[model samples]
Target chain A: MAHTPFERIWDRHVVKDYGDGRSLVFIDRHFLQEATSGRAFDRLRAENLPVRRPDLTVGTIDHSISTLPGRTLHSFAAGVARNVAMHKNCADFGVRLFSIDSPHHGIVHVAGPNLGFAIPGSTYVCGDSHTASCGGVGAWAWGIGTSEVMQVLATQSLILRKPRTMRATFNGRLSKGVYAKDMILALIGRYGIEAGVGHTVQYAGPAISALSVEGRMTVANMSIEFGARGGLVGADDTTFEYLHGRELAPKGAEWDRAVADWRRLYDLGDAMFDREIEIDCSTLGPQVSWGTTPQDVIGVNETIPDPSSIADPTRKAMTERAIDYVGLTPGTPIAGTPIDVAFIGSCTNGRLSDLEAAAAIAKGRKVAPHVKALVVPGAAHVKAAAEAAGLDKIFIEAGFEWREAGCSMCVAAGGDIVPPGQRSMSTSNRNFEGRQGPGSRTHLASPAMVAAAAIAGCIADVRTMMH
Target chain B: MEKFTVLTGVAAPIAMPNISTDLIAPSHFPGKKPEEAIVMSFKDKLFANLRYFPDGTPKPDFVLDSPRYQGARILLTGENFGCGSSRETAVWSLQEAGIACVIAPSFGDIFHDNSFQNGFLPLRVPADDIDRLTKGLARTNASELTVDLEKRELRVSGMAPIAFDLPDNRRIPLMEGLDQLRFMLRSADDIAAYENRASTERPWSFAAAGG
Candidate 1:
């Protein structure tokens, strides 16, 4: 049968089909974090359910853990009890947890791939939405709620309704200073946020193939922002090269056999998607969200869109509200909009390559005096590697605060937050109202764009600074 | 879980698009207990940023805060409601605020799944139907709406009942207040058999952690 990669992976994992669009799909890997896992663990204890496959499940403390240097579990007082609970729960359940002191400790999405746990052609489930980041390596991955988390914990499976398939082909090559972030932001901006709802998006074509695995992770990480449960690129030599010798990846003969099998995991020649969209990346610019929604985005040089010009009343109203929330004038260009903060990390853009790109821009320039710029690595290993390569020196010398790894201000649950009414240029995925903090306004951009903004003290084009 | 067969209550209109889970339940609660932060007691924080000012005073202009919409049990809003983030806390907040159902043209995929797991109904109707309901509420003196899950129809004052579509699999669980975990446990034997086959078929998937 000619099938898409999604259908191929999904067909292999069906444990039982209820014949009503619901199937008990076996999960290959499960990643858990503190914020959403506490309740799931508590429920498991209440029901006296044992973790079916403890070896396949891994836990970490990222969501609420403070990214402060020399930090302990007690550093963030509010997060302390949750971190404690995670440790206790993982210990009691025989699940391996990367605690605060573990070098493996980091954001679940980042650590999963770094540790080689997100194997190609396998099924991955996590409690956090960005678990789709694993799909960068060609895994079938998606996020689940705490109740679904309990389902995975007790049985190593989930009762999932098969989602329709959509293919987003990014044709042509991205111009210089444009990146995977811009490619994805441009797609969401062009297609509206709900375009991928009820579907798993497969990112293909020349531009997607050009992206490094880390860059593809940045693209896949934001799939949820567009209402897609999962997004992925098919495995190729690039993917195999990235996963070849990682910590938990299959070794020697197993590796050869796994690669041989993964090579056959792509869509068949006659495969057809339920929906298809093509994005020409050659003309795409470094995109920045001018308003609250990711869909309310414009190129760095573009002006804010006026709501009155919109034809659809609902979209017009949404534009008006977004503009009001973001405090932007309709005719003003997005480039010169002053920012009070610059954040350069999240599961979206917090990787070694992301750091390298930001460092290239921050090499000799100082951050603007009015801006408080921060660079939080996605994982401890990423932090260690960056420091080893002197990327930390480039950032610190540029007046950016180089911090430990975790989901810092991307989600303000860890007490790291942008203040009320302050505008920030961020590399994180979402720009929803109060997403960074209550009344905090955010402009989503690429890591290079954020670094350029930090230097210029506003949302500026990275190409201008590249030279 | 509470079984919801029929819910008849005041329906409030929030016409804004993309009412994100972050707006429904803000993430900036300081000094909250871990369990409290994760699962329960978020009624006051429901739409905290939109419903109240930074001074902790209610925003009277907000529909949820207005006197007419007090104790509203149904929310009629724009498309893509509960978009962004896979936080189940958003569902908990709406449930705590006495909202039994949310009628929208569309929803965030994760939020939709989360709603069903909690036995909360997330109704999807055509955009035209939403417009008719929005207009019907504006022209009428009464704003009460009746959602009959068993019959798959929505009844509003002075308007013909609108038929809705919900998959039987989702509807039956919510109506029966069935726990999904117990239901999944029944397939343990099937899962075990599948695992036995998968062990040889995909050995790399079960590679020991930290290998």
Candidate 2:
């Protein structure tokens, strides 16, 4: 019987099946960040359980670190102590850590993949919802909670029930200004957020194949937003090309062998999936979230949905609450909605290509006087590459603050936040209540869309500014 | 983790959909030290935004604040409760606030997994059962409900008992207060054998940690 990519990878990782629904699955790589790993490490020490495999684990400082210029350990007083705790924990546990001063330090999800730690046909785990971003390389990656993190630290294995499989095929060619961010948002908007629950989604078809590795990461990063624990894109020539010369990637003869093995990681023609859905990308427009939930999204040309028109009582109530919280009227058009801030960075869209796309729009243009715009690279290497490509100057000249690498503004940590009751155009994944800060409303969009909105001082269509 | 074989207590209703973990445990809590927040009891921080004013006074209108549901141990809410973010702090806060079970049509996948690890029951009953329970509680002014894990039954004041399904693996752990890590460690030999075989089969996976 032919097996799908998810099945093949999952079957390879099972150490033992308990005859019940649970199975002991092996974890290939584990990435840790400051905020979630401190308690897990403390617990490990308290229990006198040594890390099962220190070589398979790596840590980075990202979640709570400041992104301001000349940032030091003491830049953010609240985060300083946590950073100290993380350093001590990682040192005591014999795990390699990329501290705040390290050149490789960045968001774990971003830096892990960029460093070639997430290889094809491997299993990766992190204590972050966006760990699925590493699945761009065809790895079986998912996020876990703190307790599960402790489990990984002590045992390097987790007892997990196999999830059902779903194949989401994006067919047809993407239109200009429409991107992976738009594609994923359109999917969540059409299908409710719970559509991917109880399943691992495999993103396939022509559109997925055409996306760059970074673009694929952007789509997979939001898998948690739609309630999926994991999402993967099968490895191909494009994936191998992206991994070829990366730091932790296999060397010479080993690289050739790795590539040959990765080539077999795709699904066979007769592979089976529990559920399948196809989405057409030819007619898709740039997407922007208008409400708290990612499912509450619309195309750039569409208007905000009215709660009264919704039939389901639960949906109607949710919509009404979202609209009230976001401070938007039911029938108002989403395009002209004013925004007080424009942020372009996160694990979702903080890569080099994302910065280039945003910079392309910001070049030869000035941000509207009222909008406070900033661009934060996802990783230190990404920051260096963007600066080498002259993207930083373009953004700075366009009135967008070019900041250090971190998860700035996206999580409202390290003192970077959108003020209360103000609206922001952000490239981050979640737009839940006070996600960016207390009472701060966020509109999720692509990096290019955020750049256009920053220039226009409102939610604007990126296509209009293109060319 | 506490054992949760059975629970009988007041169930409060909050009829909002997609109650994200961010709402349950906000990232920013004034006057709380960041480093100590993780180990501290989040009882007062549960639903801080919705439950408190800017000046730090409790909002009396919030469901958990209402005098009738002050000690509620079960939460009856809409679909997709505990959605967004994999922060286990959300479960910790709810547990600290005296909530032992949450009855919703569905829950976020990560949050569901986190609940099992903490011995908290995230029960998924049909929408009709929730509707019936809400109406029954309102009509009779009897908010007490019993969740019997052994029988897999939910009993309310006036309605017929509703049966729910939980996997045996998850159910057994919660019933016995078993430590999953300790249990998995018992099979260390199996894990070692698997790893050795995997290293030979996929040598690329064990390559150096850094570039």
Candidate 3:
């Protein structure tokens, strides 16, 4: 039987096959940033481990560095030692660094794809949570721990345990205001956070088919929140169209050949998966995370769940804890709870479209006086696009703190944070307790909603605020 | 290099998805300094909101919260389990919480790698097997999972022998109790080999042959 191109890529990367169903996967493309690599590589040096394959790996400043397009990264500055240290560290490790001024500069997620470093059917790994975003291009990508960060740093390959296969199929057309974010959030609400543990899920269905490469990334980026090794989609025209003219995408005759090859990437008809889940996107509403976990969520129109309605002690305890931490009673609805801050940025939903969507709502509207609003672009490319479109001026005019790109508030780093005890509307993944900042409650929403909240200073319906 | 012992055991099921790092160790007010809860098992606390098929209906068949599935080491769950941001708290929470092996149809890509690195067995079982385990948990109340890190095979009794995708270089340490940090430290000879190769293959990489 002939294997698909995906399998071919898989076979090529298989460096060593261990008995008992394990194999050594040699990573061809390795991506890293200052925030994690700085510390991880330092540890590798402490252990005296020299990098095995410098040619196979690529390093850049993403998580902790800025996305100010065209700005030279000054090595000397106050409170910029970490950034300086990262440059020096990458130099010491012989890793090629894509610094701030590089046209290729952007968020790690955006930079990889924009530069065509992320190719079809390749295994991509990054030192960030949203690395699954690469799955948009048919690449198997995921995040790695700090220690594993050191491992990949020393050697381009990572030791991985094979994952069980699962097929999560969602069929149906999406309603307006309900994007890919809503589809995933609906799955979370239906399944909860722990529904898909120990599985490598392949998203297949009519709805998943209609999604763009960007949208597919939005879903794959959150696979970790669902607890899967990697989320993937079969290659199709959308994958090809996005790759066309892409910085790293093959060109001319090579592009035609690559497309022909990518067209054949699919699972066998008789191929069996470890698990299967099916969902319908037609009924999905705007999703919002009311509790700490992504799965502890509800549709925007729905009210916060009452823990008493849940008789299970374990679930009840979890709900109660979330309610207490979020300072809302279960019976009292999450809709009315006020928001103090609104953030729109992160590897997820920090693209040009997300910025534009937020900017549209920010225009002609003033952010509430009490609210601290921020619009952090995902990458330098996104920042440049937003600036060209004048979206930054809209955000800044509407009282949002327009700043440089980086992970920023998504992980509650570099001062893009929610104040203690304040609830924030964020356009990033994860809403765990203190995930944004110590004692700072977070409510996960779409970029549109983040803009609406920034204007209203509370969780107002983005659609309602549009007019 | 120090050798770490592999502690093998039966996989207790605490099946649920979207197990983020916060559930493992909440980004609480306290810092990373040693604390009682961090040192203690985080299973119960970690599986706080774990529910089965949350379509506003109840399915009393969950691994961590179920009485019948109690003490069963293997946790069977749906696909995309452990999806979301890359937070090691999820790994620490499960590893410390007493789940030696997590058997699911899928796993969060990053968390899957994190699990192997941390010395816990995160197994991938067929979807049918996952459903079967869930049913078995409800029927005979048995869902035993055995993970032999040395053998690198997960035995779920009724389920077929499933393969794990691990790197060859990583397999040695995992089976021999060498983690990433330890592997780097122990392979002093290998590091030297690469360094010596680097001097010639990419002369700019090294300032001088001997400095």
Candidate 4:
């Protein structure tokens, strides 16, 4: 039967049936991060279970390594130890690990695709929740839990319940300033984050067609925010081009063969979809999360949100709770809420491009005094590549801390905490209350936007930072 | 690294619903290095106060470090335990604290898998059965409950049995101390065969050739 990339990947990795509700999927590729796998590796030795399929897995340290300029092993000792442990765990499991020293190492999400670990018509799993990022390459990738980590380590298979399917189509061209992130945030706004619970979503449309691979990754990575099982895109020229010559990609005549096969990974003319959402991206923009959830958001030009304006009681209640906690009021514009901190990295948008964008904004501009900002490199290689171009120095000269490559404030790990009651703008995927630190309010934005916020000490339009 | 222990007990006794992983282990750590920075991120940032971070104050609504269950072994929780992000650290932190198993009406899909693989028996019991234990605790103001991991049964002291769902594949693996990663690594020969074949069939797949 003809199939889309999602269907092809699904069929190849299916191992068993768990009734109609669920099926067993054999993992084709597995990725591990420092935060999740450290203990899991220890568990395997304790249980005497070897991390099987070491050849199918890879590791990279991103979360705790600082993004500060002149990031040295001697400076961030705790973070350095985590990277060391990640390297150790990968070695123990026989999975290839990319360390701080590896030029290829960066955010695992970006690193995996850049290294071509995520292939068309395949299955992938990662210890990181944003493993969905692999979907950008047309793979059926999903995040796994620690216990699942143990299971994957032992068997490289997962018994997964089939999530209901949703086909979200983005037709029409996206207007300027509107991004894939804005498109997703807008979709979630229409269908609350939980709308797609227990379902897989297919991003199809002219708008999706227009997105860069990184933008597609941004779209898919937020699938979890809406509680979806996963998100996927069909393979096309864009997909193949991104994979072309990647460090771990197919080479020479074999590359031609691979492309020929990948080109076929798209929906047949009469393909079926369980549900559909058509979004006109002509009005999307620099989106900002206004409330606690990804769904609770507004366009960058909108206000802080008036809970009373929402019709749904649940939404209203949620907004009320968020407004009370975030210290925002109705009729107050969200674009200038005043931030005390600003961050520009995470699995969602912490790519080299993101750093470049943020640095462009901070190149000659200075960070606001009250805003203690940090520009974290999602991966070590990203750190190095940026520094090779002296991006780190620009951030530091502008008062931004260039720290290690581990997940920092975005996850609250490695002592990366934003003080409570402090409002800040971040580029991470989630803006859940206290997700950064206890009572620390986070408003998610793009890297450039985050840099703009750092400069203004509050939410500001990226377009305004053009100078 | 010091070894984590499993608590041997008779029955489960948590009373809340939707015991999320954020409560078990939040997604504070997402990178490969930086283990130390992550482990202590929420040590004092109790579940209740996760909403008020950076203030370093507890909201008191979180249950991770509540006084009521200070020394409890079997975590009898509400439905959908670990229902959040797929953070394995949650399982590690719980296991490190000697929580051998978590008995709830349901568990988050990823968390359940992580828990089982990490040697944490996430027992899925009926809501009614869980209610019975909750009521018993409420009446007696007691929270101590035991779960027998080997038998896959939950029995309160002097109380009748409370049945729980156990993934069939997990039975022997948990008992024999096996996990998917470990199992594959053990069958290096089989994995190598698959890798070699995958490379030959799809020579373009770098991961296959690298393996």
Candidate 5:
């Protein structure tokens, strides 16, 4: 009997199933970052246990790591402790450490796939919530707390409650300016934020198949923000093409065998899902978050939603609160909202394709004098690749700062923050109030939208700037 | 981890949906030292922005700042509470601030799991029940609530003890106050056997280093 893609991966990874809902699932790969791993490593040492599989684990300096040039551990006064702890712990445990100096170092979610560690048809985890980005390669990946991290580091397996499957099908072609970011933001906006909770979502259909593997990662990276534990797209020729020459990918006959196995993992047309939702991407435009949560979004041309227009009382109250925090009036068009900064990076939209898109819009254009624009690559390889492609020159010429790879400005933990009372158009996954800084307002958008906003010095429609 | 059989406290209603970890305990504090991160317990940073302003002055309008809910040990919240980032510090902060139980309609999966790991109770009550409790707490001057884990019920004044669901595996840990690692180690032999079989069945998945 054939199995759905999600079930096939789960069945293969289950070490012990008690004929019940819980199972001890085998973890194929484990990734860690500085902020959360320190405590887990401390717990393991306190218990006097060696890592069960060091070779399968990789540690990187992200989250609190600095993206500033010539950054040392001491350069960031507030981030140095975890930075030092992470280096010491990785060295002590024998896990492959991607130090700040290493070309492999970047955001764990991005570096894992770039180096081919996040392979197809396996279970992976990290102590960071965006670990779902690994699902782009058809891997079953999700976040865990430090306690679960300690368990996996010591035993190579975790007890998991079986998640109900929810498949989100995007059924039509995305418009010219509309991107994977827009599609995902639109989905979260249309459905409530908790729509995908307690479920592992399989993103399938013509639109998903059309997305490049990098595009799929952007969708999966934000799956947590949409309330899914994980989100995956079935492996296809597009996925195979992306992984064919990757560093840790299989070689020769092994590659052929792997492809054959991956092909079989695709869901059968009649495969069942506990719940299914379909979105028509054909009409979707470039979306922007007008309020605090990702779900409080509208198209670039649409006006801010009035509280009265929202029928759900809870949502109405939330909208009112968010508008007060964001300092926006009801019915104001989102396109003209003033912004002081534009950031083009994060695990969400920091991939090569994202850079290319932003660079295309930025060619021969300069950022407005009032906007502080930045472009931090997702990984060192991405930085090197972009430089080789001269995307760096394009961005610099456009007045955007081209920086080293790290989780910079996406959160305040990184020390690169948008100032208080200032608005920012960012390519990051979240738009929570004060998320960028104290009293800092954030609007989530695609990289192109960010670049366009940088040029215009406020929120601007990318469609108008394109071509 | 302290085993929690029952918890009775004055409940405060923070009825907004999607209250993220960043809000519960902010990741960034102005001019905070790197060494300070290790020394500052989550309790010091609990609702940093809401409880205090930039100059460290208390914010009067915030729920945690109100006199009525002072020392309130239970938080009643709306849907998708604890929605962003896997910061365990949020759980630690709530626990440190004397909040032992968090009742909501639903939660972000990681946050829910983290709460259990830290011996904090995060119960998922029905939306209507949550609404009733939030309104009831506001209506009454002194409102106390009780959460009984053994019976999986929430009791409030002038209302029925609303029943909630918890998987046996999750419940067992909280009831026994056992860390997940300690509990899993009880079946070491089975784990080893499963590993041996997994190595034989799926060798490719183990090849992370690329020999």
Candidate 6:
């Protein structure tokens, strides 16, 4: 029987079905970070079980490790003990770990794909919401809670209820300075935050086909923000090109065989979807979240929505509360909103291309005198590559701090938070109230948008600086 | 994990949508090591943003602060409660604060899974039922509500009981208090056979770490 790409992959991994909707799905790779894995590991020990497939599980310290250059684990303010616990637990369980000192250590989602652990037509699970980033390679990856993490560690499988499929096709061409971030933000802005609830979103169409693997990762990474189960972009020449010769990717004659199989993972023309959305990307501009949620977004040229004009009472209340917390006036243009900081990092936008794009804008320019700006690479290798390409030098000369790799400033748990009452233009995913700090307001945008905002000390359209 | 067949307690209502984990347990320790902090610190941080003023004094208008809802073991919240972040601390903080069950129209995926693993019931009922329960508990001035998982009904004073459905796989665990990992391990042979087949079919996945 013909099946969608998602069903083919999901069906291939199902170990056993319990007669209900639930099935024990095989996990190809299990990635772990310090913050979420400690409890799962502890629970495994409490049950007197070892990591069932230690060879397939890899641990790293991303969430609880400091991104300060030349910093040690002991220097991590809040995550020191947790980082220590991770090392101890991983060591005891014989799970391979990329420590803070390891050059490969970074965000689990970034490290997984960067190291080629995320193979096409496979499944990856992490106790992280951004695990969908691996879907850029046509893998079906999603986040699990600590308990599911424990279950996977104990049995190398997960009991999952199949989610309905939703196809979101982005057609036409993206405008100059618009990006995958803009594409997703615009989609979320049009469709409310809960648009993808109970569904796995398949991204296709001409616009998605044009995206680089890194860009696809950026789009897939934010699936959780809009409440999607996960997001997938099918593998093609671009996918294989990105995976070829990567550290953990297939090699030798096996590479040819792997490519042949991955080629068949594309969706059939008549693939069915429970729901579908077709987006025209031609008119989309640089999207920035105006309020707390990702759905509360507007184009760079647009104004904040007035609560009174909003039709939904719940959404209106949310808008009012967001305006109050963000200290923004309703109906005012968002472009000139003053910002105290600019951040370009996170699993979403911290890839090498993100750094290169931001650096291109930063070259021969300076950050606003009063504004603090930072550039944290998504992975240690990305930082090293940026340094080799002199992107780090460009950022530093522009007064943006080029830091080491980790999930810095994204989760705001590593002491990289913006000050209270200060506003920030960030390339990270979430913008919930106080997500960055106690009273810090976050405006989400692309790397170039963040760079432009840093230079202007206010939210600015990346298109204005594109040329 | 405590076996939960039934629970009776006052249900504090917070009818705000997208009540994220950050709000449930504000991630604001500010250089304080979480591993070093006392258990009470997590309890103190529960609902800190809405429950307290900037000076750390309890807010008078907060639902959890009301004397009538003191010791509430069930929470009646709006849609998408426990969204944002994969922090298990959100569930831990609520559990520490004596919330044994969360009744909502829906929940964030990870939070729903985390709640069950932590022995907390995250019951999903129809939106109308949730609204009716919230209004009924208020109108009747009912201090106690009963969640009968075995009967799949929520009983309150002077109101018709509302039925809720829990999938059998999840329901069985709650009734037996079985650890999910141990339960999963029961299918070890099937898992092994599947992996053996998968590795043969897709050997790239089992290649050496970073090759």
In the range A245-296, model 6's lDDT, one tens digit per residue, is 8877889898999888888878456888888898899988889998888888
Off by over 4 Å in 3: A1-9, A43-50, A65-81, A267-271, B4-175, B179-211
- CA lDDT for candidate 6: 0.85
Worst 10 residues of 1 chain A by lDDT: A263-272
lDDT of 4 at A327: 86
Could you list the iRMS of every candidate?
Answer: 2.6, 2.2, 9.2, 5.0, 2.1, 2.4
Q: List per-candidate RMSD values in Å.
A: 1.9, 1.7, 9.1, 5.5, 1.9, 1.8
The digit string of per-residue lDDT tens for model 2 on A1-467 reads: 57888988889999999999889999999998888887798888889989988888999989888899999877877788788998898889888998877778898889988888888888899999889999888888999999999999898899999999999999999999999999899888888789999888999999999999999999889888878999999999899989888888788888898888777768457899999998899999999999999898999888999999999887788889899989998888999999999999999999999998999899999999999999999999999999999999999999999999888899887888777789999999999887887678999999999999999999999999998
The fraction of reference interface contacts (C-alpha pairs within 8 A across chains A and B) present in each candidate is: 0.66, 0.64, 0.30, 0.40, 0.55, 0.41
- The digit string of per-residue lDDT tens for model 5 on A325-416 reads 88999988888888999999999999999999999999999999999999999988899999999999999999999998888888865668
Best by DockQ: 2
List model 5 lDDT by residue over B99-124, tens digit each. 99899988988899899888998888
Using lDDT, give the best candidate's number. 1
Worst 10 residues of 4 chain B by lDDT: B1-10
Classify candidate 1 by CAPRI docking class: medium
Clash number for every model?
Answer: 0, 2, 52, 80, 0, 0
Who is ahead in TM-score, 1 or 5?
Answer: 1
Model 6 chain A is weakest, by summed lDDT over 10 consecutive residues, at A411-420
List, residue by residue over A335-454, the lDDT tens digit for candidate 3: 656788888888788888788778888898899999888888877788888899988888888899887777778776654556667888998888876677656788888888788777
Candidate numbers sorted by DockQ from highest down? 2, 1, 5, 6, 4, 3
lDDT of 1 by residue, A154-243 (tens): 999999989999999999999999999999999999998999898999999999999999999999998898789899989999999999
Encode model 4's per-residue lDDT on A350-443: one tens digit a residue. 7777888888889888998899998877776677788899998899999998877766788675567777688878888777755776567888
What's the true lDDT of residue A438 in model 5?
A: 67
